[model samples]
Structures are given as structure tokens and as C-alpha cells.
Target chain A: MTRLLLPQIGVEPPERCDAARNRRLLLDAAALLVSERGVDAVTMDAVACKAGVGKGTVFRRFGSRSGLMLALLDHSERELQQAFMFGPPPLGPGADPVERLIAYGRARIATVEVEGEVRRAAENSPGTRFSAPARAVSVTHVVSLLREAGVEGDHELLACSLLAPLEATLVLHEIRDLGMSTERLEAAWEDLVRRVTRA
Target chain B: MTRLLLPQIGVEPPERCDAARNRRLLLDAAALLVSERGVDAVTMDAVACKAGVGKGTVFRRFGSRSGLMLALLDHSERELQQAFMFGPPPLGPGADPVERLIAYGRARIATVEVEGEVRRAAENSPGTRFSAPARAVSVTHVVSLLREAGVEGDHELLACSLLAPLEATLVLHEIRDLGMSTERLEAAWEDLVRRVTRA
Candidate 1:
């Protein structure tokens, strides 16, 4: 069977093993560059050199710098998505809607706290903050949960409201400017999710 | 009593009646231009033409286009702040935390829904979005309400989470792209507030 290519939307899976290996190398290099230098300083050439690959290969894999950032974000977000989608009971499928929403928030907080840098890098990209596929998926997940929780009226909008708390900029502002603790954030989130989900 | 100008932060309130009237005229003209041609298109000269005032008068009232937009946003935001702080009950002072939160959300939603274009214009300005006195006041108001509701743990962060849902961009996205009804938005907000404020 012939495989199809959708370069613009980036929907195609890995084409070859070497390409996959190179992609992994690029991501690892990109992460290191991001740690060493900020998002602005991490160039495709630097990533290519760090990964011991041609700059052309890097471009082929990621298309552009924004594409690379999105790819990195997608990788981490996919792990998070998997954790909430199918990995365990409370966050996944076994628990009730209220419990699941709570679990989802906790998981999200943990994810943001851990992957703060990556999340910030992705957001720093201009004009693409709300267009990430992972963001859409997360919103859809929350909306579905709100529906399951019996909250009537615009479940999607309500889901957007739920996701509001997890905004990367707001989260950063809270921890950095407001001196908020993870425990405090988690507790407030618990309250918020409970109230939003209650009958 | 002596009036001292606070450098880089506060300005002295102007005293000339005609200046104030012309400023109002300029602001009204700017608002109409914003409603018609958007904030970006409303030039000082255009404002003067629309307000039936001279271009120099427009310049005198507002130093630049940025100044004009700031003045317009400041005027509208002040009214909103006044309404929430001292206008009536529920949204003001007489109601419980839960009711107040609901009222506040609904009011904010309505405001954003109505004045979205102006709000978006104000927010798009560089270096002004976060520092605007109105934004700061709104944050303080929400924080106070969260504390009043006995929302424990990082009340500031909790307030931010609550405020995040009312973001102009998110509200526009929900209503425009998501095709949500205002009624449904209000209902979802009510549900969210009830869930968030339960003891």
C-alpha cells in the first residue's frame, strides 16, 4: 500500500526508521539547546549540529523552528494525553465524572509543573498559541467530562472554562509573580472542579 | 493642598472644562472609529474629524494613538469597575460569595461579549495589557471575592483561575468559533461558580 503525505497539517506518521531515529536525535538536541539557551537562541543549525545530522534533515523532520517546537510539545502532550486517556482508572475511565475531572486537573497540574519549560516554549511562538492539536484534544477531553458530569449547557464552553485555570502564562504568573505553591494550586483546583461538576 | 505628579506612573487630572469636553468628544469619536474601523485604524486626525475637533486638540487630549486607545479603554473599564464595586447587590456587596461570584462572572461575560472589540484592542497594545490599572483592579476584586468565599490555598492563584475564564480571547473564541449562545455561556458560568464556591 502507498503511504500518503500531508506536509502542511503534519498528519503523516514516521516514514522510515532512520527518519524516526533522526527525529529523536533532533528532539533530544532541541531539548538540550532549549535548556542551555532560551527558545529564541535555539536555531535549527545548532540543533542539527548537536544531533550530528544535516540541517536539511532537521528541516525535513520539523519543517521550521515553530514546527520543531510544536513537535516537541506534541511529544510531551501525547504522553499526557495517553496518561489521561487509557493509562489508569481514575484519570482514564474507571472513576466517575467528578473523580475523573479531579484526576484530570491533578494530572494536568503535575504535567505543567514538570513540563513548564516546554509549555512556555510552545506558547512563546507567535500566532499559534491556541492552534495546537494537543490543546484542542485536552479541551475536547474536558468538554466530554463535563458532559459526563451532567453539567448542562455548552459543555465545550464549560470545558474552555475548566482549561482556563491551567493556562501556561497564568500558571507561570501565579508561581513566579504571586508566589503560589503547587499544593495551593491543587487544592483550589479541587474546589473548582468539584463546584463545576456538582449537580 | 498641593498636587504632585507621580513620575512614570500617575498623571495629574486635567482641569479645563473645554479640554475635558474635547477629550470626551475625542474619546467618543475614537470609540465610534474603533467600532467602525477598529482600534488600529483610528488615527488622531480621524478622531478629530469624527469628533468635530482640531487635530491639535486631539493631540492635546491624548499624546498619541496609544494614548487615545488607553484613554478610551480606561474610560470603559472604570465604569465596569464601578459597577462591580459599588453599583448594586450580588455583583456588589449584599449577596453571598457564591452568588457574588456568579454575578461577577455573568457581568464580566456580558461586558466582554458586548465590548469585546474594545477589550481586544486594549489587550493587543504592547506593554500595556498587564500594567493597565483596570486589569489590576479586576484581579484584586476577584482575589477579594475568592477570599470572601472561603476559597482556601493561594487565594490569588485561585482568583486568577477564576478570572482566566473571562479572558476576552477565550470568550470570543467560544462565542465566535464555537458558536455558543450567550444564554448557554451564562448558564455554564453559573454552574462553574456554584461548583467553585461550595463550602
Candidate 2:
């Protein structure tokens, strides 16, 4: 058996173990920079300084500023996917489906500031936004969760409706344009989940 | 007082009576053609023929194919907003809030094919989608209706979630890419509205 690939939404491309670890460090540093000071702060020098590495190493790993952002987005998305798919309860398989749905929205919202710009970049290209392998996985997960929660009526579309508010694009607007907080958004997600799943 | 202009979302730029009527005729013909044969069939000559006007009139009314599509989208959006805000019963001012929401969603679903493309076109410019005056009007209307319906929890965010499934970008994907029917989407919208608003 060999490793699987889900590359359109980007599964980890194979690399040497040390190289992969190094890249993850840089991405983590970049993500932190973005979260702390916004996407504009993700310069090569800043990411290098934060990661305790030379600028040359950062450039060698990602080629340019854009390359670094793309890598960071890819890394973040894959991490979220892994967390809910294979990690522990609530977001993973062990908890009630309703709780898992709530957890999934909360986790996705937490990533909006870091991952939103690139996701918006992809959204600029019309056909690519909805067709990504990652989005498909998310939709399937939510639909299955809705079924498990015993929610009735058009589970697939309802899942889409539930997932829509958690989208990076919409959440970023609510936060940046409307001055909403992450805490408020998370609480709203919980309320929405309960409303949809309640008997 | 002069008529207030919501031009960014196009609350109708000032126009002479005959020109406005002529424009409406061309737009309606184009709308019908697209609904019958899809957006690809919306060429100037075809629109001109459908509306029983000379081709020069079509070109004069809307400079090009893309221009015509944009106007059609604008016209359609305004009509929906008017219908819900001031037109009549279920979709307008007089009906129950829950019934009004269902009507609103059904009305929006009816316009997906023609309007979805231009809406997707605007969405390519990230800031424009959420910030448009027309979208703002729609959001305000939904929030008010939710409040009127006596629903609980995060009315603004919940309204966004309810409206998200009705977005053209997403609905077009369901119809064109996922092979879903319009009737199904409309019914799903009704189901979703009920779930969110149930006592």
C-alpha cells in the first residue's frame, strides 16, 4: 500500500522528513504572523525571524511571498481536515453528531483569518471554488453528520446551509467589516446547530 | 426630494420613460431566452429578434453581450427587492414573516441561472460581493423578517446562513455541476426556513 493523494485541495506532497518538518515550522511561523498582525505582515524576513531561520531558507522552501502564503493555506487546510477526520472526539468520530458539527464550525472559524485570503483567491476563479476535493470532503462530512444527528429533510442542502456561515469568505466579512468577534461567531454556530438538529 | 440612488447595486440610473420601457422589453426578452435555452443563447441578435426590435436597438440599449447580462442581473435583483419590500402579499409586506421568507427564497431560486453568473462575476472581486448595496438590502430584509417571526439567536448571522444557500454562485453549482432541479432547491429552502424558524 502507498500514501493517498487529494491534491486539488492539496494533501501533503511527499518530501523528505526533515524538509517536511522544516516547511511546517515556516508555515506555523507564517500563520502566527498573519494571525497576529494580519496577512500583510507575512513577509519573508518576518516569517524567517519568527521561525528562527535564515531568509534564504524560507525563500528556498517556498520561492516567494505568494508561494509562502499558498503553502501556509494548504498546510492549515490539511491540518483542519486531519483534525476532524482522524483526531479526537467532538470534531472527530466519538462524540454526538450535533456536537461534532458544532465543533467543526468552531474549528473552521478559527482558521478564517489565516486561510481566508487564499481561499478568496481561489474563489476568484469561479469553477474552482465549489469543486475542490477538500470542499467535497467537508460537504460529505456535514451531510453524514446531519444524518447521524437524525435531522430530517434535504440533509445535503441543509448541510450546505449550515456550512455556509462558517465559510472563510463570509466569516472574514463579519469580523473585519462588521466588527464581530470569533466568540460571537462560535456561539452563533452552536445556536444554529441546535436549531437545525432539535426535535 | 429626488429619487435616492443605490447605484452600486443599481437602484436604476435615471432614464427617460421610452428608454426605460425599451430597456425593460429587451431585458425581459433576454431573460426569457436564457431561462428557456440558458445563458449561452443570449446573443444580441437573438434578444433583438425575441423582443421584436432591430439589432441596433439591442446594441444601443446594452453595448455588448456581457453588458446585457449585467443589466439583466441588475433588473432582476431590483424586481425581487421591490417585490419583497413593497410589491404584494406573500413575497411583499402583507404576509406572515415565515411565509414571506419562504416566498423570498423561492423567488431568488427562480433567478439562479441568469443572475448567478453575474453574481459569480461580481464575487470574483472579493470585496464587492458582501458589500453590494443590493446584498445589503437583502440582508437587512432577512434580519428584520427573522426578528418579526420571533425567532431566537443571532438574527444577523442566522439571516446570513439562511440566505447563503440561496446565493447564485452556490445554486448554480448545484444545478449545473450537481444535477439538481430548481424545484428541489426551492423545496429545500422552504425546509431550511422552517427548521430555523420553528417554535
> Which CAPRI quality tier does the interface of model 1 achieve?
acceptable
Q: What is the lDDT of residue A80 in candidate 2?
A: 82
Report the number of the highest-DockQ candidate. 2
TM-score of chain B of 2: 0.81
Q: Which lDDT tens digits does candidate 2 get at residues B55-163?
A: 9999998999878977876787888877887678799887899999999999988877666666776665676778877787888788888888999889998888887
Local distance difference test, each candidate: 0.71, 0.82
Candidate 1's TM-score reads 0.83
Candidate 2 residue-wise lDDT, A52-137, digit = tens: 99999999999999788767766777788788777898887788888999999999888787777666666656766787677877
Error of 2 at B81 (Å): 1.5
RMSD of 2: 4.7
* Per-prediction interface RMSD in Å: 3.0, 1.1
lDDT of 1 at A150: 80
RMSD of each: 5.5, 4.7
Model 1 ranges with Cα > 4 A deviation: A1-11, A113-127, A150-153, B1-14, B95-97, B121-131, B149-154
